[model samples]
Target: MFRGTGFGTYYYDVRQVEACDTSFVAQNLSPLECSSQNALSLNHVNSNYVVAMNHSQLKLDMSKYCGKRVIVTVNGEQSNLPLFIGDGCQRCAGGSASSDVWNAVAAPGLDFSYSVLEELSGGAACADGHIQIAWEIVDDTIYNFSDGVNFETAPAEASEERTTSSAALVMSTSLSAASFLHTPVNDDPVQNAVAVLARQGYGDATEASSNNALPTDGLLASLAEPR
Candidate 1:
């Protein structure tokens, strides 16, 4: 989602690869490696709001959104996020959000920092993990992150609808997977990392009857085959 305009729905999780995890670092899947300079950390202590999307499914060029700030609205709660490309996962859209951003928008009693993997995979239903969000790019002319200015409150005129081109609308939809597939995993290191994470119980036990859910069998098989 962008600004106030509605974009297509996508799944989200709060799982993050720790900076010190060697497996993630070797595969270049760590948050620090995947995100831009604007999003250096996902620790709860940092106030920088950021979200990552699977690089494979991201049809647009990374240069367009990286380092740019967007107001992400999830379940009617809003946070400012810097966009970045992340490791890929089947049927997982809007890949992950920082713990701080998750805490800000998540319902009461759901703490991402306490149990990252459980919270991500223990949702009541697959739809519970789905992120119905809307986002809008912050106008760089009005607010700049480098200036050390904080945009705690949205602009007064934020509610007013702004016109976007067909290209922008198309770009929004392209960020998500249009269909679920069981195709063989290719040579992408980011995807290989996803497979490894799955082996570590990422999405192994999630009950997903829906077609949109990630295929656990496919993820496991990726490791068995050579790229």
Candidate 2:
């Protein structure tokens, strides 16, 4: 939903990647008042891109997925290579008016374009000729933009195996398959983690179905195979 504050004659233009521009004519679209909010959704992957006007706010929303490792590209150019949601935007800040919140500092006098993606589901479907706000969850953790001004902080801990690199670490713990199965996926470190977990099995017994056992067999087989 691309809307400006205190609008006069504002144009909301949208274009598919490498495609011609399509314009949406809104008479009075202001962020202050609601009436011309264009709702849209996007499922983005490599090589998928869209262009639209006034997408500065959109960039902030998408920055959550990136954390510090990724970049948000605009219109075939890297304007804000590593973008973060600024503190002041009401939509991004969860609708709180805090003095501590800082407004996004965009490059002056630049009209932004559209598009973002990464696991967005169940939004009010875009009607004919309306734009949708699409997004995916890079990490579900709440990002505090005001947690100091370093954009390089990586978002969310990587799946286990990021820490520690010693097979001896697992040897220190008693290797009870039952106890191992119950171990929470979160931990300091574990070698042969996935295979070990797969060996014992997964899922609550109550939730088991015929197909539930099939994938685990393949996983165990693969893990047991020589590298």
Candidate 3:
């Protein structure tokens, strides 16, 4: 156990082993980022794949084709991702795509070509979230790829924001009025320091008799930005 700041012992790991069917096995897991094995190809620019959690990993060894270019895709949507290598690899050939599992935390699918030495990296996403990358090899250049796609954990509410001209006018009038108050304070330091707030949106500022209190002049005009 690692002794430190009130935290208990922490450990992490991943498994990648190659089997006879041209696939790698991945057992035990730690949060690790993934990258493509095929480093140089054209198709890799716009394709994706999937890798299962704790199953096997995709292969990277491409000794079979040392001087050719190939394209690959990687797609995934799983958490608790792993990095595969050698025997634990899900695909030893480094060329294939995978389908996703229903209701799975995160699954990765990759399309890459094996043309040379493969660098198996981990924790590509940094957090426990899953991120997928693809590899391609053409001619001699090695290409790594993935598109910037984000899937929200929760589905978006299909709602619209609506406000009429009268509503806006009323709000404006209310702000510079004799009596005005805002909702809860925001995180901005400037708002926190404002001890008093008052606006004179309505009422005239003309000098009526000295007996009557002229509507207070607006010191706090348009205090908050309209959402």
Q: Which candidate is the best by TM-score?
A: 1
Worst 10 residues of 2 by lDDT: 27-36
User: Please, what is the TM-score per model?
Assistant: 0.28, 0.18, 0.19
Residue 110 displacement in candidate 2 (angstroms)? 12
Range of the 10 consecutive residues with the lowest summed lDDT in candidate 3:
1-10
lDDT of 3 at 108: 36
User: Which lDDT tens digits does candidate 1 get at residues 77-134?
Assistant: 6643333223222222332432223322321111122122123234422334333445
Candidates in order have lDDT scores of: 0.36, 0.29, 0.27
Write out the backbone clash pairs for model 1. Answer: 1-135, 2-135, 2-136, 3-135, 3-136
lDDT of 2 by residue, 78-177 (tens): 3333322221222232222222332333211111222222211112112211222222223422223223223243332232344443444665564665
Error (Å) of candidate 3 at residue 124 is 25
Q: In model 1, how large is the Cα lDDT of residue 212?
A: 39
Candidate 3: residue 60 lDDT (0-100): 32
**Clashes, model 1:** 5
